[model samples]
Target chain A: MPRRTTRGQAAAAASARRPLFAATIALAMALGGQAGAQQACEVKLGALGPMSGPAAQWGLAMLGAAELAAAEANARNFTVAGRRCTVSVVSYDTRYTAEGAAAGINNLASQGVRFVIGPVGSPEVTGAKPVATRHNLLMFANSYAKNAIGPQWPLVFHLGPGPSEWAAPIVLMAQQQFGMRSVVVVAPNDQGGTDIASVDAEVYRSLGITATEEYYQRGTTNFAPIVTRILSSRPDAVDTASSPPGDSGLIVRQLRQAGFTGPIGHLGGPGTEEIIRVAGGIDVLKNFYWYEVVPTEDPQVRAIADEYKRLLGRDAPENTNMWLWVVGARMTLRAMETAGTTTDTRKVAEALRAMPVDDPNVGRGSWAGQRFFGINQELSLPFGAGLIVDGQNRGVRRIEVGQ
Target chain B: MHEFWSAAIIGVSLGAQYALLALGFTLIFGILGVINFAHGGFYALGGYVAYSAVSGLGLPYPLAVLAAVLVTAALGYVYELFVIERFVDDHLATMMLTLGLYLMISTGLLAVFGPQSPEFSFPVKGSYSIGALRIAKENLVVLAVCGCAIGAIYWLIYRTDLGRALRALADDRQVATTQGMRPRLLFPLAFGLATGLAGLTGALVTPILALSPSAGDPVLVTSFLTVILGGLGSIAGATIAALIVGFIEAYASVYLGGSAGALVLFIMVLVILLARPTGLFGRQIRGA
Candidate 1:
């Protein structure tokens, strides 16, 4: 009887082992299938930006836009040269410094990323361009510095509007709409601020408007003294040229509180919503004007912006810089399709220059920068004039700026 | 003349906020002989707490300020009990510990609140203008609140038994022990009070300035300069220094460019330090 009981236990153990062996085989087959899929035509895109510092919001927005583009491409099974390819963006934080940019670029290069987006600010581009050129990597940078573009940085592509281009139309609009004959231009005492202030001053001069420039340190919170000085000029408008969203919002609020009833104009894109939100309500946003590439009135553009908001759970792209990145990513992917290869930087760069960008979000764009940077590497999109009415950023009409 | 009046009002408003921050720093350093770098973090935390109270829970601004002070003071007590108590006499260790605390709190704030700057509006709106000079009602309210707070702090420090015990402890801990004063109890209470002051200042200033996780950094730097310039443990000196610094910043930014203004102020502080190592009003310490 004891022998029969032992036989039954052995039989049960044998049945368990058979099922386990079968399950192991199934798991191996599944993993093998995944590995094969991963090995088939993958493109690694690197995004370098200040992901951790005060400028972290810009980086986060850029990454979010890129990831959104990548997900859309993958969902559509985006293919290049008859090969099904998956685009993946690996982000490196530059900490908003030149040294940080260099390290980030080197790290991304080591990871074999041939196509890069950002190293957002001009200073970062200056720091990372050498490393990028050495790696033969194609970089689409969100910079306005003319020095960052042209023949000096062959592998670099400027993504946004140049300072002159961005400020010219807004100054014109301010003059035309509000009869702004004179303006007070306030900017942070930083590279971007200096650049924008100079450009706005030039643009205002060209448009026959007197521009009084005032600057505050990067982290200056108390703007009463500065506002008083600005109001002392008694300008027709207050031009917050290219300040960060937070700083610009503070300046606007303070300017209003200081009893300046003139029109307030801001240069740049998408952050208008943030400015509106920060300034308390749309009433504060009255008489405020900004410029952007995105045509918010277009149903397709609105759909894309809404989708981005839904995907990221953030305010619709209020940053034109981020919108530029989205356009750059899409354009890069399109160039890859045109060139039939993602690894050949020269072919992709040439394709990008030759291609005309007419997308739902950015409208009609062309290769500009010939007159300014001596190279047609900057994507010049038709800009839209935006007005804040009842706390909403509504697109007024498309305007010809640089191109 | 309008610009000057505006600059003066702005300077005084900013000076009041700096005074509160410096007062807390001086008090903590007076009793503990250690610079509490985490004071700025406590300040930022107070702003966030008040923001959440008003924005999320729909509390009145006054109640939010009260809630922030209480919450932050309790956290300060807990922090002292758990972390600060371990290195009481070792100044270097305490500095490192507080710095770590600062980093942790700032990072935690960023993680929770995100990097976006949040604006807090005072319930009061608009400004009162007096012949080309406009003063925001909120700014006036902030000044009034700060004045009341400073008065309360003065009364607490000079009038109460707790104040006497704290003074005794600051003067000589050994003697205080003989006089039946408990160092452990008094130390935590003092720390809490100092942090509460920081929290109150944060709450008052939030309506004026947008709140960000790193917003405390500039305030922290200014507070350090204030304490050093005024005398490390001198409350009265800190108040005066804060006003000087505030007025200098306002005028300098307007006359010189913003960066140049900051440079000028720092240079002045450097010259002052060179002239008087003990600071403008600081008493000399014995044995180092």
Candidate 2:
């Protein structure tokens, strides 16, 4: 009993010291507060996108757009309040994977960045947004498909028009112009199927257009069998939602090579140039239609295109390129200068949600009725149409008919 | 008719890849009593090496292919000397080791090259048409390249001194040793030959197909079944079986649905096991 009592007394002594020790450390930290914390105000921004792999091209484009927006803010020296302020953008690579996106969001959170743009592609945005919510990071990207982004807004700002928004227009055009009633939607099983199927069903039904949906493996080279099935069905139009411009180019080339003449369209497949290059020329993939959200060479875009040529020694896809991230970074710098001193994430996030995308580098309308930097809590995706042509690098140069 | 013809040509081209893959396995199984599950990695490595050699090294496509063959053959030699040779006579050990090596090589490839498809450019242009039917020139090239490979291999194995050594080694390793035949030296030579064939196939076909690290997986499976249906150590048997398998799969996939390759492979295995347990060319290599 005496020994037990002694042991209990010893435990009581240690437990009593734990909180006291913790308080001392806390008091010391309070006494030694950061010297730079006296600054007026500051906000943090995030530049998130796939920095590697097949989708890296678009991811960088999105990042560039954000940077350009951020840069404009720094130049103007706009202040949110009496406190001097500025923007600081922290960039992270998602690698276009769900897990990678989540990790990116977490890393941005660690840097106190609350608003994020990019991570193009629907699946990637979907995966990253939940992580954003968990960490209070606002998210948006132009690479999202239609259904994947909208109607789930507030926290998720879609930087491009949803499927119902973009493809609905195309399907409507097909019916009105070509007098087509029946169509076939061919897409890869995972990436494009869900959105394309839903849009094909909803939009075609609304237009009194009949449509069939066929799914194939993404890496499939011999699309002859699938082509045969579609040809037999005798659909008025054949719309393919395949990405990897290389594979799509190959498939289309094969179809034509095998003499399957028909109207072909691509929603948003493959890197624009790589696909064209792989297809050898625009001859095979000509007349194919696609959706573009970013404005092309509209002075702002023109300057960036010129710079890209100087930097990368080549012309990049004006809209599909990393315009958003560049704009985001620039906007972030402005937010930082506007906020003045110490970095405050909440202030930066609010500034980020308010900045516009009107730079001479990115799209003028990647947001709601506004190009970019619209102060709307609701984010919007930019929407435009493109026609694949047999031009410089088999690109989709014509955004208009008969041009 | 277009579908039928395209599918036939595509299937034959795919089967030729299978034949190349199968020949490698059959050579080892026939001569060394070992089943290698790592053949696909050799095929994948061959393809990636060929790609890098052409694009990164700035070498001509043909020279890149030759380089790929030589490098992969050397890889095969090292694989035999350090790994396969140590566990040569042990079937279970060899099987497990090959599986481990397969995983290692695949994961290593993923780490090095990443998980995206590498696109290869076609060497030539346009297609040839017959009457109302049209076919890709690339597919025809696939057929020709694979055909020439098989023919060359057939000649090398059936009508050469090295072929005699391979047959002699397969029949009785102990007796072959008594006859002054060293398998240790000959093993690398045999592996180099087999792996070189697979490498050539990879180089030839990458231009027409989307090649990832796992691209060779389907070809490897078909090759295994082909060799099993043909007799072990029978090059002629494997080639004929490959063509039959190719045509049947093509007919089934085009006319029917996606299960044709699996279904035909099943039927071929069934018939070979039930009717001719020793295979179609079982008697060709009785002593070897």
Candidate 3:
């Protein structure tokens, strides 16, 4: 009678295990389906910039920042509309030329990249815009040119704090911190330089500061003669209006060597660390100021800067326009997620337009260009005016300008 | 008066740097009847090598400069032995070869050192103010070093037996060969000395101006103009033309802006060529 009871109990246990085995098989199939879905979803991002020429530092930094954002997104197993997605960037060197820009855009288009970033200067953007329009690709232009963005180039998005927004703050700082009256704006002899310098002069005039404009050709290495001439005028402050990072560093170092002890400023360039490295050291960069989009003190920004240093073994893109590109990358991914498709760029563009301003990477950006480019496609944001004190970027104050 | 004096002093100091670069170019051309497009590559290499010695190995600045000169001199010797000697007789072939060598060296430098400009503090600091004119202490050091180097080069070319052999070979390679002078050995030695001068100049100016892979480009262009204006193979003429170009650039930049300064330089070159095809101090080619 005990053996019979044992057999009946074994039968009862086998009957009870059937539902659990079925449930386990169902769970495995579901997970395999999700993994397959994730493996199938991939987004391609293209970046066009001067990656190999004289202006390569800017391109490398911008490309590195965008790639970093995409890598971080992929690490989190970034999902779009219940499908796991991966992001990758394809980069082409534009050589900082118009013809090069057109070639880069066409190359990226041929590679089937629907979204693009950069072709950074005004002339490059103007050259690449038509090719981008022809391919129906969305472009995130890191340009300050008023003519580069509008309703005409509907797929192009201008990423900024444009010149008008940043120039006044620098002038104000020069006036308030140094009690400066007269200023000299040293600009490159290009469209970008002329536009930035003109805006600077207008701001200086409005602020009642005597402003003198000086222009130098691009690729000028020797600034001693120019600095001497600028000093001869005896301006209270000298502003490098939209010079490249290397040029700005040369200007400051030569100015100091020429015994110009007044405050110096640059409207736009790379990060403070790059300028410092190029200028030799903190001793040469004394009394220097520039505009930055991200405050160095922000915890998230600090984290990203630390990661960038760890990866690149340099402190570039710490507080540069690279941060703006990073923000644009994140916004691009967010738009793709909201639109629920990576291929439909029109929907993604609309989603980017409707993106909220309260993002942590870039704080409170608005649609700009209504006054300048005849459309509100440019994304303008609040920027910080930073002073280089003992090789550190000390954020002085935030400059708020509306669209 | 202060502005004028300042500009003059600045021009002279700038001229000194240009003179050092031009001397090297003229030396190579005088010895080897080929215009070495690779002279600029040697200049850039010297700066980068010195930078590595100082920044990577933590050597003293002077020691680093010495190391750079030795390394570049060795490189020049090897380059001539392996590459330049093959096409010495054909001007066009040698020109193409040197240009290829320049591209290779510059591209290799970019790969190793990266695109960012490298910076190191100048050993000397502060400026001396004489009335309204201020001169940096570093500039004085540059002038002194260049003067010594130029004096040494002059002595080497004029006083020594090796110098006599070089001049003999330059005048007539067949005659020099018949006189028991080995062309193979003398060519490498002359090339090495010329590149050593280039290396030394690059090391000296690195602290003043930032070092980039393309840093040698402007120096190459300016050196070409100097050698051309000085009549190609005339060291004395190159020295004088370098100073004139430097002063003109300084003044033109001040008066007519930066681009105008370069434009003025090109214009000066054109006028000089039009006026004197053999250059101000150039002698007629013996064979021609």
Candidate 4:
């Protein structure tokens, strides 16, 4: 049955339905907007290091750290500036050279990156610092140079203390075990090499060990001549101070082949595995000692490997530097989150400085580069001194900061 | 005195290896009038090929080296015939082509093997000690092999009929072609021979030292320096120049230290170039 109604009644009914339609439209729009917000506002982090050539392991570790941190941040549903954001990383290979690092900074800056995580060599950091200053970018760099972190570069931070902080303990421990009376420290003739070798030699000499520093050209492949020169001195120990892992390995192999059986002390950085691989085997490194950036044997730190594999769907880099770098990268992201801004690097830097130097995996550390680099921007964490006595790995012993 | 004799022994060993590399470098420039920037790529490829043959395929070390030589030589022959032959006369074009190939080869190696130096060691272990002088058995093996290779190269270039034709083409390409000597056929063969020598050197020396993708970068610089110091395109000049470089590098590194040793060698080369603009053995002009 059809019911007849007056025009005014029909108009009234239409008006009433309009409100419901409006309500439905509003509800749909709100849901769509929420979805858009979840996928919006990208924040990019930059990594700079030698991703190729001999020093590639260090750089790959840096990049890996950045990636793992980003993945973890995203997993936590990281937010910045009060909006849901996805953190991404862009990497540039510095080739372990000055010009390359400078150019890398410029390139990263062009892509709107305000945070950088690495430039793992002295030359690269030196090259990147000025350019980073120009661009107002915050950097977390790793280099053994004396000036790796200085007050002049307010935005720069160090991943951890270098040979300056850790070399003495390693030297003392090595001396106690190996009883090396005379040692030769071999490195490249560049600033990257000289700075560390000199510091190491000073440490050795202060301990009353006869120390001599020998510098070779950076690209010298065959270390035979240098090895010969080293052997002729009849050194009780040879320290491959700050030489790239590949170079150090070749020197060790050649030394062993030449029948120089003194314990090889690498008071530089971690590359014991690479050196062992190149030198043939652990037996080739009959007696060896090295510096590890962190107490790698620590269960908490060891868990990072399992976590990285779980989250990243692959094994972490072979270099233990990966664990140290993860702390740097995670701290950077946390600072960014605390500052509530991705573009404002100054705020992030301030936030980083104010925050406690602590990590779940690496444990706790304090900012302590004031006496050396004229700034307190260096992360001084507990590191390890590794030993191999009679071709047997004694494992890494953790040494607390300031110990 | 012990140090002096040790440096000399090292210098001789180094010279032999350098001669093998430089001879290959000069051959391409001499016959094709093309600077093969990819020469180093062949050297690195040879090392990787040998490494894979031994490590991946379970071949014996000697067979692996031979496989490396054959594979590199064949690749070089194909590359020359197909790509490089078109622009062989255009030096700039050939330079660009070779440089591009070098990049490709290096990048490919990096992708396949990664950046780290693989665990590759010489089959012969230990060293021979004569009094206070010590030499790695591997180094002596390399030196002996290099000496034999150098002698064979001389015989091939100076005595063989194919060598005569190749030299005729180098002397005057247009005339040699008019006289029925075919560059299209012989040029590829020459390039193959050069690249094969480079591969042989890499297969021999890399195991003794280290085998990484970037290992070729230093090899290229050394080869270029040796070739330029001797005389580009002059086989004898390259040989003499390599020995001089090796001796200087050894003596200077030993006496003056590694840093100053490299500087001294460069300064000596600079002085030589200043005195003789054409190099120690270079001619005024190439007939080609």
Q: Go through the candidates in order and give each one's DockQ.
A: 0.54, 0.26, 0.43, 0.79
Q: Which residue pairs clash in candidate 1?
A: A269-A320, A270-A318, A270-A319, A271-A318, A271-A319
lDDT by residue for model 2 (B1-288), tens: 666666667667667877877788788777777777877777877888888888899999889889989988898888888888997888899898877777786667767875555556667767888865567787777778778878887787778988888888888888988998889988878887888877877777766665566666665676777887787766667777777776766666556543344465578678776898867775544453
Off by over 4 Å in 2: A1-119, A123-156, A171-182, A197-210, A234-237, A305-321, A324-360, A363-378, A388-403, B25-64, B82-120, B154-181, B211-288
Per-residue CA lDDT of model 4 for A101-142, tens digit only, reads 999999999998999999899999999999999999999999
lDDT of each: 0.80, 0.64, 0.80, 0.91
In the range A1-403, model 1's lDDT, one tens digit per residue, is 5555577788898888998989999999989876776576688888898765446666776776787677667777888887789988899988566678889889998987888888776667778888888889999887655576878777899886666776776666667767878887888776657776777788888889888788888767777778877887788998887676677778888988988877888864346766766677778867888866555565666566676766556665445456657888888888988999868999999898888877666677777788888888888776667765444545666776543
Q: What is the lDDT of residue B136 in candidate 2?
A: 74
Quality of model 1 by C-alpha lDDT: 0.80
* Residue A351 error, candidate 4, Å: 0.9
True contacts kept of 3: 0.50
Maximum-DockQ candidate? 4
Q: Native contacts retained by model 1, as a fraction?
A: 0.60
Task: Summarize candidate 3's per-residue lDDT along A184-275 as a digit string, tens digits.
Answer: 99988777677777787788888999998998877677787788789889998898867777778778888888888887777765456767
Best by TM-score: 4
Please tell me which model should have the higher TM-score, number 3 or number 4. Answer: 4
Ranking of all predicted structures according to TM-score, beginning with the best and ending with the worst:
4, 1, 3, 2
